[model samples]
Target: MQDKINRWLLDNALAHHPDQQALLNDNEAIQAASACQGNDAEKLAVFADHLKVSSQLIAVIDDYRRCFDMARIVFWLVAFLVGASSAFALLTATANHVNLMSVTLFCALLPMFSLCLWLGVSLLRFGQSDSISGGMLGRLVNAATHLLSKLMIAANTAPSVHQNAVFRAGRQWVNPWQLSLLTHSSWLFFSLGALLGTLFRLSFYQYDFYWGSTLLDSQQIAVFVQISFALPAALAGIPLNADLIASAQLDQSSIQTDRAVWAQLLLMSIVVYGIVPRLAFIALSQVKLRQSLKNLPDNYAYPLFRQALKRIKSLSEQSQQPMLAPRYPLPADRAAHTGANTIASIGIELDQSDRWPLIKEDTVKDLGHLINSQQYQSALTALESLEKPVDVLAFCSYARSPDNTTLKRLRNIQDIAEGRVLIVLCEQAIAESHQVDIHSRLIDWQTRAHEHALALVDFDCSHKVNVNDVLNAAEREQQT
Candidate 1:
């Protein structure tokens, strides 16, 4: 997963170059990659391995990876320390007295507020396609990573313009949800650090806890304390009564001062308010981030990646085709000069049981079937030995499209014939249901014939072919 992202990022960076062919379209490399059996990501990984990505761009990617990892570590470490220091500073009481309201608010205030904001943003942005922006914490982490990446680049004495541009693009590909995941994890660490900090302060130090209020009486303060600390106190098994609350007031001198109950209430408050919510959001952020990564390629807006995918598909199709033997060239110098008007008939790749057209000429020579290389060579040899300017009739089935091998064979026959060659599309065996397919095949043959400057004459075995009439039709089609 780590290197896959890097390779894709590098490929995208290379695609933006003006000379794409020189940079990316290496024929042998493409063929090699296409030969591998796998999905797009696996094949693209092979392709990237074959291509020579620039060393500077490679360095930039490596640098980004290092900086991102380091920034994650540094961010969490800073968050933990900040949490610990804030807890330690607030818990340091003045004149051996701890204010209950100030202690509760200091531990719960920032984490609760930020958590509410995160929950609101998450609900509003759920299932949205945009990954460019995230919540406040996510934005802060992204900014920090970006700054660190720049510093890493600056430390290098000379960075290429190409590397700089690719760096900018690669950084933009960062998913905001991934940053949000990091943000949630950092908060989790902060909560853990605050918990440990609170335990350490309360375990080692002794202080009297009290509340002083100018506007409210002790009864009102008791009511407020009961309402606020009800859940935490219940979970901690600490009894909260009006007598205990009134005795903890500053004006009322208390002979009973066991601060253990107050410490338990504070720890429970930090856990319930700070730790558990961050943990839940961290899980939610992780799930969203994974989904975003899984759908990354599909959501890529660049045409170049799509083009590269298409190119891979085309190359794979080409690679899967069966290898074919080389086509033999036509016999050169087979022209005859005896001046006897003759007709030579040959069927290419046709069933031997199928009858050839009955030609009304004494000089007609049936050169058997030209199905394989040996048969083709023998027919060409016989035609070379002819003693007249012989016109050729080449027969092919109209049941299927003319493939490259079939076209090549026709071209070979045309080259060696003395007078002229006419393609006879034998359609007598075709059924009426395949008439539409036959018409399409005929159109394809006509286009191929036009390309090679050959002529065509439809042949039916039921009809007798007049040598002169067929010759005339072939000549007319060739001229047109």
Candidate 2:
């Protein structure tokens, strides 16, 4: 089922380019067999645990997609209704011997005019998720930042091809919501406005007015009649009609009056049903996220050496326990230190006895090699070996990345591990986090793991940062 869904996503994404066909095919296969799957209690327990994480990630992506589609549909429907109402007023006025120019002007101008205004407002107000910039500046800034980061990472790394692969992967997994918002919002504004304009023109021909004699004289009832019907039409029509000045002499007073009332009602409905509800949802989501972050354990101030000692003890205990033996045990007496040249071959240095020094270039290169080789066991071993608490980073091509595997590994470590784990990621690679709903799910995991002594390190590398300065600062602080 998961493979099918992934393939479907690939198929849709790749419809315009046949070159991606092989990449998608490979992804489907990797996702099928990479994670653990079994019926044994421990294995089941582990699988179920990872499955929950996978499910959360999938749900977030699905929900965002669902919202995108829904927003599009609603915008179109509203625009159509508005246009139809405008047309109805125009036709009714015309049937009552209203000026042909006035009727034509109102029908043509009203829908088009209002649509432009609405589109402007929507474009200004709506934003893509994870976008640092809100409008034109944001799109430009984001693109520039991404390109620069990719170029820098490529320039600094050896094996240029591998670096390129990582950069592409990072781009793919990083901005799912951002892309969705941009595409869906644009579609909603244009398509819906067009539909609404057409509907209003059609409605104009459907409604007409009727009159009856009354006891009140024309002079006595003139004010009342104008106020009752013409006021609304005037309100709804004036903002929409470009030629309102030229048609001022026509008796469109009744139609204008009706339109004003309908427009007011529509505004009220939107305020009540749309704007308010969305605001409430945003507030609620923020509150929940805040509470979750606050509840995370404060492991920052703890002495790094002491924490390493504690981790060693915990790992030792778990390894000896019959029911909880290490899934993949390490060599009993592995060397704690390696020469600079041998570092990549030895992988991550997890032994607490030997202080793990921060080596930026060595770690990054080794990680890239491990990931490319599909040596997850070696990668896990390497990650576990790290003594220093610096953030770990990885990249995968969007079209041919091990994003799901990386996500699963992170989830498992967060869930079962006993110490702080911080994963710093580039902006281009952050889309998977949104797609997997990492924020909410991580919060939930943190909540559940509170009693088990776990802490999460937030490496929010997606934000703009001075990479060299950040690494230097971390190194200086580690030395302290």
Candidate 3:
């Protein structure tokens, strides 16, 4: 977990360098120290000590990945099944020694090859960025069209109430008619091919069997053989005819005279309307879903932390005493310019400090308003503006001094702030030596934040209350 956190943080730090260097530097040092502890238990102990870092964002990421993984699994399963069916057909035809076997082989190979290439390209395209907006839009349109088409077909096929009742009552539980259709089509093609082959062999060998002599002459037998082959060909023409009608409907002028024009048209329609669209929809949906997950707000922490900081600041202000003094005073040279600001500079200061002297009541009220209005961006902005190290620490430790939710909010704030504030808070938390449970949560949060380059706050709040001890006690009670 520490390793994962380190990697996540380092990646983020490198990506957003100078602005995030201070936070990254502090975390790297702490992570190195944690790494020195050899045992898994000791490492886990360190993680437990700071688990409150960013639990919610991590949870959300995990959940999104799980859903995406499931979708990929299902899509791959379907693709595999289709590929297998095509392979089986190709193998069977090759072994049969049947005429037109070459045509069968071509039919089986083409779709499978095309689909594999499409899938490979789709995966490569989606990996580049998180916001697959175009893909999502395409998927939505396709899914909507597919659903509408199905509804239209159902509407067209609907029977009258009396007819519907009769049909429903006569229906086989497993749709035996569908099975019959499959069997009939398969047997028709295979049987016709076998019959034609046998007749061809008899004619070539000059066999003079009893039925051959009585039922038909050589010319008649040749005609019978032609008809046997023609039957399968004619039956196969249904799909070709359907394709011609569909193509004509799409664009009548695109149809041209070719020897196998109907077959070409049919194959084109199947590729465009049936196979290509289905695969495109799946790929589009996956891309869209991934983008949505990536773009989901990590601002959940901001509002809560902002509120906590405001409250603490308000209490301190109301007391007419600074609860905590600035550790480092402003430089003497800068202090001399206390009254040297121009009118333009005054305006700038006011604009910059718009939310300063943070009042808890007002901050909470604003958070409530944002939540009520669903103004997530505004809320995030407001929360991120609370930059004081002590304020951040107070906010994180307001309730139980390291609640999971609070830790998660801090992590998110860290992501947005992309500054040293997160690291400062982590150090403060570790120094306080509060409850062990709090320390443990904070450690975990720090570890994760470090990995994600979100900034880690180390608070050793476990002197009095061992987080593991409390958890073990709770577990014992639960078991009982």
Candidate with maximal TM-score: 1
Comparing 1 and 3 on lDDT, the stronger one: 1
The whole-model lDDT of each prediction reads 0.67, 0.35, 0.32
Cand. 1 TM to true fold: 0.60
Candidate 1 lDDT over 1-480, as tens digits, reads 787577656766665644566545553345445666888767765665555445666777777778778878887898888788877877785756877777677676567767877767767777877632366656677777778878887776434655665666566567777767777778777877788888898889887888766887777888878877888888888888877777788777563486888888888988887888878877877787777666665312355445666777775674456533222221233222123556788877754335654566656787767668898889889988885566677777765456667777667766666565667777545522333234334656777765665567565654556766666654454344
lDDT digits (tens) for residues 27-98 of candidate 3? 322332243335433433333223332232233223333433344344344444444444334334434222
List runs of model 3 lying over 4 Å from the truth.
1-71, 90-270, 279-480
* Candidate 2, poorest ten consecutive residues by summed lDDT: 344-353
Model 2, TM vs. native: 0.23
Query: After superposing candidate 1, which stretches have Cα over 4 Å from the reference?
Result: 1-4, 11-19, 39-41, 54-56, 123-133, 155-173, 213-220, 299-302, 309-480
List model 2 lDDT by residue over 1-480, tens digit each.
434333232222222222333333332222222222432222222222232223333333343334334544554455455545654454455454333233333433333343345347546656843322222322433454455544444434234433333333334432423333332333333334433443454345333322222454443334433433343344345342323322232334543324333333233332332333334433543454344334433222224213323333343343345441112111222111212212221112121213222234443324433333456566656655655332343222222232444455644543322223323222324434223323323333334323333222223343334335444443342333
Query: How far is each candidate from the true structure, as Cα RMSD in Å?
Result: 16.0, 21.1, 22.9
lDDT winner, 1 or 2: 1
Q: After aligning candidate 1 to the native by TM-score, how far in Å is the CA of 63 from where it should be?
A: 1.8
The Cα error of candidate 2 at residue 239, in Å, is 27
